[model samples]
Target: MAERSIIIIGAGMAGLSAGCYARMNGYKTRIFELHNLPGGLCTSWKRKGYTIDGCIHWLTGSSWGTLYRVYEELGAVQGRQMVDHEVFVRVESDGKTFIVYNDIDRLEQHMKELAPGDAGVIGEFCNALRVLAGREMPSDKPIELMGLVDKLRATKALSVLKAMHKYGRVSIQQFAARFTDPFMREVFPEAMANMPDLSISGLMMALAYGHGRNAGYPVGGSLEFSKAIERRYLGLGGEIRYKARVERVLVENNSAVGVRLADGTEHRADVVVSAADGRTTIFDMLGGRYVDDSIRRYYDKWPVYEGFLQVSLGVAHDFSAEPQSLAFRLDDPVQVGDQSRHWMQMRHFCYDPTMAPEGKSVVIATYAFTNPEYWNKLYADQEKYRAEKQALADAVIDRLDKRFPGFREKVEVVDVATPVTFERYTGNWKGSYMGWMATPATEGTWMKRTLPGLANFYMAGQWVFMGGGVPGAILSGRHAMQVICKKDGKKFRTSTP
Candidate 1:
């Protein structure tokens, strides 16, 4: 057989991973990215002397297990140091402070102390965490390509299954509602850190991973981590075209054969894979002709993750003693755009030395927008957009000053990225931080990589999967590669850095 060629769209984790795997399996591959750089949404930008990480709080599989294997294969974890924080987050309200200790025992103790009357609920939740400790997320195969053996291997772990079944559809908000204590009811839902709709089981699994020290922060932040995979892909002889925006998937005879660049250049390939934004790929690039009722329902009704704005501050002072993440109620509601923020969450880069200059620190303050469309529209008017950005920064800086007195004057660089920033830069639909929202109905749900009537084409990215992250992106690409190799009757292969 002749050598097969693959055209992958987007130089994000998924696209890069697919290229790497394609090269490992003896297929020719090239990746096209819209940005001059790689990483897509998994990126970081330099401001002044600090690097602001736009994605990844803590990678789910920095230490070991199935995800670790994927990270290893993609060269994301090769010689990479991970920082495991003792405290996941420290949240405060009024006079009360709640710390989410990565150590489960400490968490239980802290919870029990705060809400002794809700000890039963706390114990139950913590016990569930124990059940999920070291539990591996299913990555052996995508459901579309899984056989009897693969299915069996996936479900053989009865403990994980039982835990998942009991709490898989239950939201963290629902679990928090079970607590009798007022404080527990208020803060328990926040343990997952703004993702209240995430399954309780999913939250448990994260705490487990954090407690087990398996998932930790990659020292180099998001972009460098992505560049690691890009390097691996290139090392494997895969090609990448930066600033090469894909205009459309070239379909002939109901099969993807190649792609046309935004520059009007056509490139032929034996198979075409999209790791770009989901809506853009299905509707815009493909002309919305291949979608079925199911696909339409997904794009129409299924909620995409929304409402994100990040404010990064480069402080001349060190906050190494402060928890990696801090969430607290504001004395005054800071109004920015259409949303008023009474609460604040700040993530410090004290753990990662690469993020800041020596003796300085990078602090990121996150605020939720009621509507991403507000930012999208606001971008059209540059004056309003710049003012809103400054307003948000000013408000956050004021709050930061309140939290740590005398620290405001030490601030050097202040950068604000709104939802429009994500959409404009990564071309992600609606500036969604994660592709699809992780709701009770969405979690553990599988979306088909291939659309009906579209052959020789597959999708790999956060958009294809609901539980969006670097790991999911990597696995989605691997799944695409596996499906392609299987179709060609060739054994799928993976090589480590």
Candidate 2:
């Protein structure tokens, strides 16, 4: 039988993962990417001899388990050094610091010492983390492929499910409100201010994963990790066309047949897989004719993760003794968009030597949940956009100088990427790096890959998967391939590097 042909949109983690699996299953595949380079949102760029990493603070499956196996197969983790941090985050308020240690016992003791009045809630929180530490993510196989025995084995996740049930409905804000200590209340919410409505279950699971060493930072950062997957796909005889932006998915009698490029070029394929932005794929590329009411409701009502403005500085000062991640309350509020931000979070790359010069470090401060519309409108006026970026960078530096004393003098390079920058580069909706915001209402929602009344076409990436991240995006691609293989009456197969 002749091999089927597939065209995958966006050469990010999902697209690359789909290509790898397609090739392994005897399918001829080609990927189309808008950017000249791969990795979409999972990317980095060099500025003044310093590499500013834009993504991947801690990969959930960096070390072990089924997700790790997937990474190993995709060559994302082959021979890569993974760094596990002892302190996940440091929260500071009024000159008092509270550390979130990777060790559950240590974290419990620290929290007790900081807020002895709220020791009960702290103990409960730490106990939940302990329970999740022993659990592992299930295999990557789709639900249709799971047998009776596999279904029975899934019972092992009962403890995790119970834990999630108890805390999944409570938001981080609500969790913080339970604390009696003034400092604890301020620190708890600030620690997770970026994800204010994020469920406590999500919080515990992240801490648990970090404590268990499953979540670790891959050395060399996002671009290198993506390059590994790109190499794997290329090695499997898959073809990729860079700077090829798809304008539309050609449909015949409600079945997808191919795609038309932006420059009036056309290519036909037996299958079309889109790992691009969800809104673009449905409303723009497919013309929004194939979606049902549920899909419409999701697109209309579901909250997308807010975009962020990242200010990266190449500092000559060494921050080897500082925590990798730190969040603190600002004495004076800084103007960001229309709001005044009283808290600031900065991530130090001192642990990774490859990011900076021998004695220097790359320090990044991200202002999350910034309104994309504000940046989008500001970008229309080129001079104003550039001016605002510079002003914001200056304000951030001035504030940092107060905290670090002489930080302004040590800064050799400053790079600022706004929400508009992400939209221009990766084509993400509203410049949202992560797709849907994982709130109490949308925590475990599983979006269907195949749209209603649409055939020979599928969707993958962060958009389809709630709580979008590297692991979920990669797994969504694998699942898309599995669904395609089932439709084609072929067994899905994967190969390791």
Best by TM-score: 2
TM-score of structure candidate 1: 0.97
- The list of candidate 2 runs beyond 4 A from truth reads none
Backbone clashes in model 2, listed as residue pairs: none
Candidate 1 local distance difference test against the native: 0.87
Worst 10 residues of 2 by lDDT: 136-145
Compose the digit string of candidate 1's lDDT tens values, residues 1-497: 77899999999889998889999999999899999988988899999889999998889988988889888888888888998888888888888999999899999999999999988989998898888887775775877777888777877666887887788889888998898888778877666666677778767877889999987999899999999999899899889999899999999999999999999999999999999999999999999989999888888877777767888999999888887888888889888678776778888988888889889999998865347888888889999899989988888898889889977799999998888888888888878877886667765666889989999999999988876788889888999999999999999988787
Q: Give the clashing residue pairs of candidate 1, or none.
A: none
Distance from true location, Cα of 8 in model 1, Å: 0.3
For candidate 1, the 10 contiguous residues with the lowest summed lDDT are: 437-446
Q: For model 2, what is the alpha-carbon lDDT of residue 140?
A: 74
